[model samples]
Structures are given as C-alpha cells and as structure tokens.
Target: MRVTLPLLALGALLLSTGCSGAEEDAAPPPATPAQDGPAEHVFAPGEQITADLTMYDGDDGRRTPFFSGYRPTIEFRHGGLSGECGVRLPVELREFPPGETHTVVLECGTEVVVPADDRGFALVEDGVERGTGEVVLTGEG
Candidate 1:
C-alpha cells in the first residue's frame, strides 16, 4: 500500500488529541535535548510544506488511486511538557478493495509544533488509527 508520512526533524514526536483552543502564535522555546546532543528538537511556527506520496497496490501490481482524492484535514494537540505542541494532518481515502495501495501528496499549509505535555498527532482512517508522526513549528509565529 502507498503511505506517505511527514518528514519531521530529529528527536521530536508529534501527536494530536481532539482538543481545540485559541490559535495562538508564540516563539518556540529553546531546544531541549531528548538525549545528549547539540539539540534534541527545534520548534518554529507559521511555515509551509509540500510532500509527495507514492502508493502501490500490494495485492496486484497496479497502483491505487484512492489517495489522489483524499481530503487533508488538520488538527492540533497539546504536548506532555509545557509549551510543547503537535499538529496532525488526517487524509481520508475513499473505500477500495481490501489491501489496495493508495498514495497522494499532502501539502501542509503551515508548519506548527506540538505543545508541551502532549503527544504528537495520529493519522486516522475510517476511525481506525493508521500511523503516528511528529510536527515541527516553522517560520514566524
């Protein structure tokens, strides 16, 4: 199956929980080392992104076009530590035969970060969780 995931910076995990609040923009706090290194993660705000996805059908040697029409939905959630945050982009695909490959490109309009004390976002399809990814803040907040 064709699955595309976000390209996040090193040492950061993004998560989403169905919570909403003011779309506040703030400067990202200094990077905290998850392990001993230059910096564990970097968080910025108000950035743009473009991603290309390739989907392949496993059952058959044909590529599935289901993801081409998938709608991209965005959401945000809090992080475990204070000031940390995460964003989730959930793309919905039309039903297909069992074990069909589907791929598409997800264009994240803006780059945001996972708030502290919360996990990163999760990708859900038809109410079933498919994958997990991280979100980094970019640009001016």
Candidate 2:
C-alpha cells in the first residue's frame, strides 16, 4: 500500500512535467509584415539614365579621395514633365597624392537632358547611398 502511494506520486509528477514541456516547445507565432514600404525603385528600359562625374578635391588639408580601395557608384534621378527617371553610374579612380587634386571623366549618356534643378544624384555603396553630389548628364551618339 505504501509503495503504491509513492508510485502514484511519481507518475503524477512525470505527467505534469511532460505537459508543461509540451506547452513550452510549441511553435512560435507568425512574423508580422514590414512597416516601412519598398526601399528601392525599379526603372523601365530606355527610361533609365546615367551621369558623368568629375571628382575634385579641395585644398582643405584633407586626405586625397581614394578610389582604388572602394568602387563608387552614382545614381541620378530626375523629375520632369514626362515622369521620373534614375540611373546608376559606377566609377573608379586611380590612387593620387594627398596634396594633389585629380579629375576623371565618367562617360554617361541618356535620351534627354536632366534639368539642373530637377536632378538629384547620390553615391551608392552596398545598395545604400553614402553621399550626395551633382553630376552632368551628356548625350550618347
């Protein structure tokens, strides 16, 4: 009789523990959707644009712009009467001395001339724009 009581207690303890563990191991709830909308814009063919960049280093006693270490990408966007157009330009600059300022021309062309005021340009890195700059768009032959 005494042994029976001890066995009953042990069985009850095991059952309670098993049930609690099952509850803890249940699957988590579904993930919620993103709050912010789409971060990137998709461009149509022929509507895409490109830009030419002339990088100039000022005499502010700063280090010369290094291009060999990193590849710089530029995205130009314009809002006009027709619609909005954007282009990405990849740039590479050779290493220069800290005291010297160098200029490199990037060849970029589009069907239309983006107005100076309506034009917006950005330096892209890792899918994100690191800095902002002005670029002149030229016509292609």
Candidate 3:
C-alpha cells in the first residue's frame, strides 16, 4: 500500500509538470544573426571610405579574407548607382586590426550625388546591406 501511494504521488507530480501552463505561455527565444555572411556598410559618393573586412566569418572558421584569397571585393550601391570594389587585406596578423581597411569610392553620374539628409549610403554584398554611411551635401559632388 505504501509503495502504491508513493507511485501515485510521483505520477501526479510528473503529470503536473508535463502539463505546465506557464511553459505554453512563455515567449520563444530571440533569433540570432547569421554567422557565415558578409556585413554591410554605407558610404557617400566620392568619399574615401574604409571598412573592416575581417568582421565577417565563414563556416570554415576563417575570416572573409581567407575565402577571398586576401583580395575581397565589396559591392556598393545607393538608389540606382552600384559598383564593385576590390580590397586588400592587411599583411599584419594582429587582432587590433583584424582585417585591412579598403578605401571605397562611390561614384554617381558625371557629378557625384551625395545622399540627402533623409537618405543613406548602402554597402552591399550578395544583395545584402552590410553597412550604411551618412553623407552631408556640401555641394562638393
């Protein structure tokens, strides 16, 4: 009788835990960013821009530089303007400067068109926005 009583209590406890209402009402975990992808950035037209290429990590446990053979190419686009630029990775192997900073130049029509106060420059890779840079129209285009 004692053993049967204890088993009944244990079963009740298990049933209660398995049917927890709190668990059903709990929120799900947030989504995580992609690990193997190029980061985005923005830049102004005709402005010299530099970006960290090592921030992107591939599934092979190596940075983007290793995959690109040290010559990583980034795509820049704003509105209807778009172009690809090749960047050289830093020769040094230090964490302080993990990757080389390549100057990105965005060109518009014949005259460089700076983004208005409401617009932004978009750095793209594989059709993804990795970074954005703001430009003040100083009439220097």
Candidate 4:
C-alpha cells in the first residue's frame, strides 16, 4: 500500500508538470513584448527611411551576395508602389561611405544600381525589373 501510494504521487506530480506527452503541442499563448519575443514592427511607408539595403529572393529563399567578394547595398523596387520590409540575418556585408553609391549583380542574374546608403535605391534583377518589393526607393532621391 505504501509503494502504491508513492507511485500514485509520482504520477500525479508528472502530470502536473506536463510530462504526460500524449497531446500535441498547442500554439503558445501571447506574451508581452519583452517577455518571450521581440515586439513586432509594422513597416510604414515614407517612414524617415534609414537602414541597410538588402536583396531577398523569395523564390528559393536564397539571400546571398551577388558576388563572392561584393557587398552591394540592399534596396528594392518591383511592379507596384513602394513599401517597407524587415530584414533578417545574412545581410549585405561590404561597407561603404554613408553617402556613396554602388552597383551589384545578384546571383539570380539581376543587375541592381542604387545608393550605398540605407535609403532609396534601385534594384534591377539581371537587367530585368522585379515584380515585387519590400520597400522600394521612390521619387528622385
């Protein structure tokens, strides 16, 4: 009887600690911004643009530099109006002066020309204009 009681207690303890492992995991509850994850930042257009330029190939999820030793600025433009987007790891590596300009050819056979700054720029894919964009450099900046 004593052993049975101990085993029962152990089982209860395990269950309380979520050790049953029988149910599929559910989506986590929403957490505070500083609690478990970063606070989401919605991209706003004409939002005093100041950031790095990057290239993202949504087709194959390849975010690589156009050339092995090249680091072109990350800017964009597609078939429609301009907008903003968030960047992740594997960004442009080459550094440039804040007000300089450079051109780079993406591995996807795209030719891009734009400012080396994080502001407005043009993205030409292998000489062909893109169909979409995260945030395009618009106007005559």
Candidate 5:
C-alpha cells in the first residue's frame, strides 16, 4: 500500500508539473495587427445618402465660396451642360445597406464617395476629411 501510494503521488506530481507549461501555451485569441485596427468597410442596410459636395461651377447647381469656387456646387455640371458623376473619393455613398452604390450624379466630373456609418456617410477624401452628411434609413434590410 505504501509503495502504491508513493507511486500514485509521484504520478500525480508528474502530471501536475507536466501540465504547468500548458497554461503558457493556452494563450488568449490572437489579436489583430495594429495597422488593421479600424475596419475598412462596414455594411449598412436600409439607408440612402444625400451628399452636397463641392464641384466646379455650373448653371444647374448652387455655387460654393469655399476654395475660391473651385470645388463644386450641390448640383453642378461635369464640364458644361451635361452633369456627370465626377468626384472620386474612397468611400462610397450608399443608397441602401449592402445594396447597390448611390446613383446620383451631383455634377459633371465631380464624384463624392461617402464613408457611411450606421447613421450616414462621412465626406472624407483620401485621408483628409472635408465634411460629412446624414442619410435616412429606409428599411431594416
């Protein structure tokens, strides 16, 4: 009995000591890279955007005094007469969440990519943020 007890105790001690290193191996979930901290794109459903970006001068849309009237108006023309989607921003102004992109030609050759959140889109071009706009939710889809 004494021999069996010592053998069992040794076995238990060995087992416990062997598992002690396991705690170190059992680490938490791997963390994301620091550069990949912020999410690039987020899905937003049941919403639409109404952006008022600055574009070149035109007869149809209103003009802006900012940047010496070089940017754009609310509804400006691409070059002249014909209004086309021109502004090219990184973010896309969404019409509906996870749906098709916004299909509104503000001015000719003036494109506005919207950085949309749950509420609306941010009016930021590249890394420089010029402004932001709100969107109306249309559905829960």
Candidate 6:
C-alpha cells in the first residue's frame, strides 16, 4: 500500500509538471529588428504594395526571416478606400545564407500609374521595385 501511494504521488507530480501549460500558450520571446541588414523601399500608385525582400537569421539554427516563413508582404489602404484598387509585389529570394546585403530587384508594370500628388509606397524586392501603393506616401525618412 505504501509503495502504491508513492507511485501515485510520483505520477501526480509528473503529470502536474508535464501538463501545466500548452506549447501554443507560451509567448514567444521578442524578436530583434533586422534593421542592420539591407532594406528596400518603394513608392507605388495603389493603396497596397507588396515587397519581396530577403531576411537573414544572422544566427545558426533553422529560422524564418519573416513572421510566417515568407518574404515581407504588407497591404494597406487609404481612408475609406479598402477595396477600390490594390497591387501586389511578391519578392523572391535567389540565394541563401547571404554573404552580405543581397539585392532583390522588382519590376513595376506601367499599367499601375502613380499620381504626382498621391503618396506612394513601393515594395522593393532585393533592392528592386516589386509592389506599389496608390495612396499618399508618408512616414518615411
């Protein structure tokens, strides 16, 4: 009876430790900005722009540069113009374990026209233009 009690206690302790929390519930550590690496900036004529830029882990171990293991892709719209017009600039990577700041050039088709007065944000894929925005550009240095 005593042996059974001890075993039960041990099992209970193990269970408590093992099942205390879930893997998904744990918060991920804050990620450092890849500011030191290369950056691509562009200006587009549509409300949305897509960028194809390469991100380096800068450390060993299997890691994804972007949040979702994909290239940097962002979409934004101006006031009340959510679905009117949009553009997509998909950035592609041509190399891995980059030796230095790699350049990804993008091509902005002539179909999407950019207004002189409207602000624009272009997606630069590897230092090239890939995607563009249609709104007034702001908040850039």
lDDT of each: 0.35, 0.44, 0.41, 0.38, 0.34, 0.37
lDDT computed for candidate 5: 0.34
Model 6 agreement with the true structure over 1-141: per-residue lDDT tens digits: 989999888888878888533356868899976543223234454324333333333342124332223343322222212222222223454333322223333233222333334433433344443344333323433
Lowest lDDT sum, 10 consecutive residues, model 3, at 64-73
Worst 10 residues of 5 by lDDT: 75-84
TM-score on alpha carbons, each prediction: 0.27, 0.29, 0.28, 0.23, 0.23, 0.19
The predicted structure with the larger lDDT, 2 or 6, is: 2
Q: Model 1: residues >4 Å from true position, as ranges?
A: 1-69, 72-76, 79-119
True lDDT of residue 86, candidate 4: 27
- Tell me the TM-score of model 3: 0.28
| Candidate 2 segments exceeding 4 Å error | 1-65, 68-71, 79-104, 109-113, 136-141
Candidate 2: global Cα-lDDT? 0.44
Alpha carbon lDDT of residue 110, candidate 1? Answer: 43
Better of 1 and 2 by TM-score: 2
Tens digits of per-residue lDDT for model 3, 1-141: 999999888888878878632457767998987553223334444344433332323432233333222222243234465555433333454232223333233333233333333334454555655444443333232
lDDT of 1 at 75: 38
Query: Per-residue alpha-carbon lDDT of model 4 for 2-71, expressed as tens digits?
Result: 8999999989998999787477577788885644322222233323333334344445323434333332
Q: Give the root-mean-square deviation of each candidate in angstroms.
A: 26.4, 16.2, 16.9, 15.4, 13.8, 20.0
Q: What is the lDDT of candidate 1?
A: 0.35
Q: Which candidate has the top score in lDDT?
A: 2
Misplaced by over 4 Å in model 6 are 1-54, 58-71, 74-94, 98-100, 107-141
Candidate 6 C-alpha error for residue 126, in Å: 19
